[model samples]
Target chain A: MHKIWAVVRREFVERVRTKWFWVSAILGPVLFAGIIVFQIVQSMGGAVRNVAVVDSTTDKLGPKVIEALDASGSFRATLAAAGPGVIDSLSNLVESKQLNGFLIITDDLVQTGRAEYQASNLGMQTIESLQRTLGKLVVKARLEQRGVNPGVVDWAQIRIALDQKKISHGKAVSDSATQSFFMAYFMAILLFMAILLYGVNVMSSVLEEKTTRIIEVLVSSIRPFQLMLGKILGAGSVSFFQFVIWGVSARVLLSLRGPIARALGADPASVQTMVLPHIPAATLAVFIAFFLGGFLLYSAMFAAVGAMSSNEQEARQAQQPVTYLLMVSYLSILGLTNDPSSTFARTLSLVPFTTPIATPVRWTAGSMPTWELAASLVILAIGIVAVTWVYRVGILMTGKRPTVKELVRWVRTA
Target chain B: MPEPVVVDRVTKRFSGHTAVENGAGKTTTLRMIMDIYEPDAGSIRLFDQVGGGRIHSARIGYLPEERGLYPRMRVLDVLVFLAEAKGVSRRAARVKALEWLERLGLADWRLRKVSDLSKGMQQKVQFISTILHDPDLVILDEPFSGLDPVNSQVLRDTVVDYRHRGKTVLFSTHIMEHAEKLCDRLCIIARGKKLIDGTLAEVKHTHGGKHVIVEFDGTQGNARQIFADRQLVAKLQDFGQQAELELATGADAQEILKALVNSGARLARFELASPSLHKIFVDLVGPEAATAAASGARGANGGANA
Candidate 1:
């Protein structure tokens, strides 16, 4: 045991000291959150734009329509001139950059309800401006056609409140409707990114050592399973520690969450109201089990690949086939999270390799049955032992590359 | 104490090739110490008390011809690991490692990566690692392959120290000089067969004959005619006017001198030097096997990555 620990501690220290690890183990989450916020900002910021419109229709939109559309104060719509670069041709205005964009109400507009939608991804702002402006014209036309004054329609829409009862069991109160979906998605994504980050971390760490020939010395002292276990736990602990800081940081920085999120380029609104309500303690217990079992079970196999490869580069190559399998699990879980009872997701959840990632996802989605989850965990336990035995024995075989037939024979004899 | 190693007829074979084929053609086999190849047809006892491989391998250190050290591992770390594995306390391992590094004049390089070290330095580090466990017996297969004079001496000194400390060291080297200088006894294997075994002098004694040198005056052509009796003339020299001649075993040197002088050949010089290890190796293992011997065994210049 001391020898095993000596091996483990040495591996732990060696890995933790490396530049690649500190970069990934410490910086990976920061980058992940950064990317998320960046995406949100990019998405929301691109949703609005400025545009101008000119009508060649027989029946033109009223002046009030433009004012009504402009009244929202979301974007600026410049009414264009009637010349060569006029508002009649959207292509010209956009090409000249004189206007951000324009909408042409062609001669058949009122008679035909068809509206074409086009916008450069770089010019996505044009989409919203056209929508808002044209939305006003349609509303105005409908009101006038219904013989209701536009003022009455506008005044009537000024607001009527439907007080929704937040009926929990028996109580009557109101809460936001979209909050549950947002909360579920947040929980699901958190479980996802956490698993992925650590799993790849396991892979990359194995790759680095495999490439460096350090694994050879390491395997001499401890079994490969122990090495893999120690690394998975050690790295997981490091990641877990960081995540704890993130959790505490979230609470301690509650006031600063907004600023931090913005700085990180993530959005607070995305995960807001996204908390699961009253997770059964048992389900959470299973999730923790599945998480550990999954990391160990899969990470051991990863360590095996590391052992088989002569260097880090080859190990990375060997890891891809397994990683792609993990990816399938992740994708299937994504489908499962949508409907946990779906045949595909539930079936994969039982497989030992995919179970680790998929089971927890289904649990979070509240789709896993208690017996099935127990069975998966049991299968995972067996896999851990069996794989550990193989990894431990196989790691020390020098210079001989075992082929599939050879591996099968060895396994049977073993 | 029983002999440190004893091997009674050992043999080893690979798939189709035999590495240490058999005990046949053997020089001298260790009877008391640990024998490396477990006898396929006999037995080996190590340290006088223990028998079998597990006992010997544990007590006896070995440096295989194959490179076995972790390439990227720190030199000190690998040494210390081996030391501790040999049952030394971690502290002792550290202290011993540093002492070895300094004694080997590698003190400044205690922390350098093993792979970064020159091949000679790396070999030295491996040497240090092999002996740090303080095994009573060590079997170094070609220990002095890639080394310059100075580093070779450092290793040579370390081996001497091990001997001074009463450790019995046995190493195989194709460098006859290293064996001549360091070995107390040897079992030279040629074509996977031992050719000779004994103390240097013992074997040289068996190689009887009072050697004679006939440095005839450069003009003394047809020198064989001067000592034309094939029975009296053991060999003739023909080295572009400087030929060496060894008289037949137990032949009188005076007879050759008389013959050459009677032939009116003026002698330039005369002297006798004991047979060198190289000559003995060639004679016993055959001239072909002698040529197979590598010249640079000692990093006499203190190089490790020779």
Candidate 2:
């Protein structure tokens, strides 16, 4: 045990001292904050477009269209009298960047519901806003023509919203669908990144020792199994440390969102709409358990891959199967999150390979049966033991990477 | 006290390849003693243990034939970590590591990464790491294979020092001169079989026949004629001013000396002594094996010598 601790200390201290660890650890939260800040800035609003409304219809609809577009606040609209040279001049204005765009209301606009928008570049948001304004005006004008009151039409246009709620423990919870989806996605990605990153770290560490021929000296002093275990635990601790840093920083960033938004010239209330989903203690526990189990299972297999490979290039080529396994589990996360109680999600949650990621996502996205979660944990534990057996045997055997048949043979015989 | 190690008919096979087919397993034997590889047949005892179940690694320091350390790690840290793995306390290991580093003339390089040092310096650091914890029995496989004469002499002196301190040092080398100079007891292996093993004197007396050394004043022309008599001299290795001869079975050494004197050869010196370890090794393993061993030593020493 002391030998194992020594190995663990060496692995941990050496890695933690490297620039890569700290850079990546801090980069995660920085990138995440950058995304959040970008979202907030985008929601605050974009630059208003300066455009003109050309009147070509027998009835003057240009001024009314200008009034509606100007009221929307996204476009600065000015009225222009329609003439043969009007469009050519507007096109030249757009070409020279003097004007953003122009909307032409033709005589057939009301009858044929047709209009032409000309711009150098048309943004989706600008188009959607313009469509909404024109549609409303056409409805209001039509209603007035049919002898209906304009006040009634305005009253009827008030928007209605549907409040989303999740049911938990036989009661309706106040969590929104968007919040639940985000929380599930965040947990799945966090678990997946932690397991894959730290697991590969273990593999590269093993490969370093093997290629350096340090394993001979190490195995002479301590058991190979102990050495591998120490490495896995050490790398796992570093990953967990990074996770703690990211989690705390995320929390701090989320709590300070209002001040940050205000500092960035965005309305604090717009940022406040991004309320985090409330994670229960039980769900957090499940996430941690699955993370650890998944890390162990994958790391042991990666260690075996490292052991069987003679060099870095060989190890990289050999690790594809293990990496693909993790990728398959990760790709299934979206499906599991969408329908956590579906048969596909439930089956994947029970399989040890996918259970670590799948089960946690399932539990967070929907109500999972306690027995299913227990069974998944138990099977994952068994998978860890089996992979550890392969790791113990493979770490000492150096040569070409073993085939799948040979790996199975080692597991069976060892 | 029991012997440091005893191997009783131990054999090890790796898949289709036989690592130790017969008794010629030198490195394989050391690995079994260290419990790095288990024996397929027979058993091994270390430090008087009944079976090679668990090795008392703290008591045994091993330097593998393939010499390497964590290249990116500091010399001091690598030594300390290895010592701690062998059950030494970190504080004690650190102090001992520094002492060894200084003794090996690597005190200034203790903080430098292993890769930053030259190959010879890295080798010295590896040597220090091997015995840093002060094990009772130190096993070195081809320890002097890649060392310069200066470094080799330093390591040789250290091995002798270890003996004076009552520690058992078992090292393997294909260079017969190193084995002849440093070893009290010697074992020669060939093709996974032990050709001979005993004290230096006993092996000489049993396998080495009558041997004579003659130093002549003149060049080889006169000596070659006298040594050309195959019936008198079984084998002759002629040097410019000196020559060593192995007498034929039942041949008298006095007769050869008389013949040299009568042939008008100026004799500087003549004496009869036990055969050298190199001669015995060549005689036992044959000329081909001797040439192969010599070339292997030269190749391994080429890096340091250059």
Candidate 3:
């Protein structure tokens, strides 16, 4: 245990002090800060303007169109010299400051049963509002022509808002759901990058020793299992420490940006007592377990792969399959966030290859089952054990790639 | 204070190939000495405890052929860690690591990263890691490869120092010179077979037995004939100008010189050569384990071997 700890300490210090650790660590938060502000500014941006119209519809729809649009006050359409549907010549009219957008009704509008809408979507929102107003006018006109009363029409097509509310089982994903959503992903992506790279660190280290024939010297004192565990744990701790610091820094930044409530898109006005998502102690425990399981599972494979090669290049090439597995887990997490409880999502959260990221994601989203969480953890535990077995086989491999048949033979017979 | 180690036919086999196929490969093989290896095939006796597992806790120090040191770890920390792993008390390990560093002229590197050190310096750290616990037997396999002449000399001096402290040092190296200089006795093997094991002189005399090579420089136009006339000459060869003859039991240098000078020949150079390790290698291990391994497959040959 002490030996393992010694190894872990060295690994953690080495990784944390590296420039790459910080570069990746800060990249997520900076991008988050920049993106949130960018989005918020963009979402709130728009011009308050009125849209004009020149309907030349043969339906002969009158002031009912004007009255319906007037009630909304969002659009001000006028009867103009130019006739029906979209005003195709608005380039000239808009240039002359006649309108922000226009609809021109064609003479065959009723017969054709289609209307044309056009506008500069950029530099104004006038066209969008006008489109909505035009849609309403067309509907009302059709209803009235069929002798339908406007009151009954409004009642039949009444707008109902289904305000959704959920009780969070855990804290980490609650106050920071928006933050958690982005954060869990950020944490996961960073972890993916770190694990993939750090795992290769362990691999490259092993390969270097093997190539130089230093592995013999090392193995005499420490068992092969110890060496593998030491390296994987060490590098994993480094990756973990890096994210913890980054996560804390991000939370600080989030709070400084007004409040996490505002940051996560909770209505800024409705947020009287702003509370960030609470990272429950239980969730933290789960994360630690997942992180350890994930790092070890991958690190062991890397060590095993590294043992197969006598040089860094081959080790790197050998580690590719595992790196790809990490990538798959990352993509799966994205899928999970799309709908954390979905069948595909839940399955990914259970497999050893994808569970590290997927499980934590579903856990945060309050979408995973207790049984599923335990099962995933158990599978990951088993995965780590398998990593050790493979690593031992990899190191003793005498200058040959361990094919499936060879591996089975070595495991079963050796 | 502990009794010497004893290894009894300890054989380590991987897949079907065996490394360290027998206890005779180790000099600690004195019956009272304990051999350290896994129980399946080998037996070891260390002090009153006799077992077939790896050397117990901290009694023996080992420097495997592959140097194992954390690259990023401080030189002191690595030595101390290795020392502690060998079961030294914490304070003692620290004290010893520092003492070894100072003795090796590396005290200034106490806090420096092992990776930043020169290869030889890193090798020093490994050496300290092995001997810091001060065990009776130090099992080193090619522990001196990366060292410069000075460091090698330092390591050799340290080994000598360890011996003076009554500690036994048993290490393997393809460089026969290190073995010849360091090992009081050794066992030479080739292709998983022990060809010779004894004092240097005895082994040389046993397999590549010592032979007398007398070189007499002269106008040797009739060198072959001159040697032929002398029945006391066991064998004769000429290297362009100088004629070298192997003396049979009855022939001595004085008598051969007396015969040469009486025949009106003046000797330019005359000397005797002893059998070297290179000759023993060619004769015993059959050219491969010694020659090929020393030069080419410099791979795992020195390691994973008895």
Q: Number of the top candidate by TM-score?
A: 2
lDDT of 3 by residue, A191-243 (tens): 67777667777887677667655454345455667778888878777766766
- Across residues A201-265, which tens digit of lDDT does each residue of candidate 1 receive? 66666655555434443443334555677667766665565567567544444545466566756
Q: Name the best candidate (by lDDT).
A: 2
In candidate 2 chain B, what residue range of length 10 has the lowest lDDT sum? B295-304
Model-by-model DockQ, in order: 0.08, 0.52, 0.25
Off by over 4 Å in 1: A22-255, A259-320, A334-355, A358-403, A406-414, B2-93, B110-124, B132-139, B192-285, B290-306
Model 3 chain B is weakest, by summed lDDT over 10 consecutive residues, at B295-304
Each model's number of backbone clashes? 36, 3, 30
Q: Across residues B129-198, which tens digit of lDDT does each residue of candidate 1 receive?
A: 7777677766665666666777677778877777766677667667777777876565566766656666
Q: Output the worst ten-in-a-row residue range by lDDT, candidate 1 chain B.
A: B297-306
Where does candidate 3 stray beyond 4 Å? A47-118, A122-137, A159-194, A197-201, A259-292, A324-378, A396-398, B1-4, B12-20, B23-40, B44-135, B143-147, B174-177, B200-254, B260-306
**For model 1 chain A, the run of ten residues with the poorest summed lDDT:** A175-184
Candidate 3 local distance difference test against the native: 0.64
lDDT of 2 at B87: 90
What order do candidates take by TM-score, descending?
2, 3, 1
Q: After superposition, how far is residue B239 of candidate 1 from its true place, in Å?
A: 9.9
Q: Rate the local accuracy (lDDT) of all candidates.
A: 0.59, 0.81, 0.64
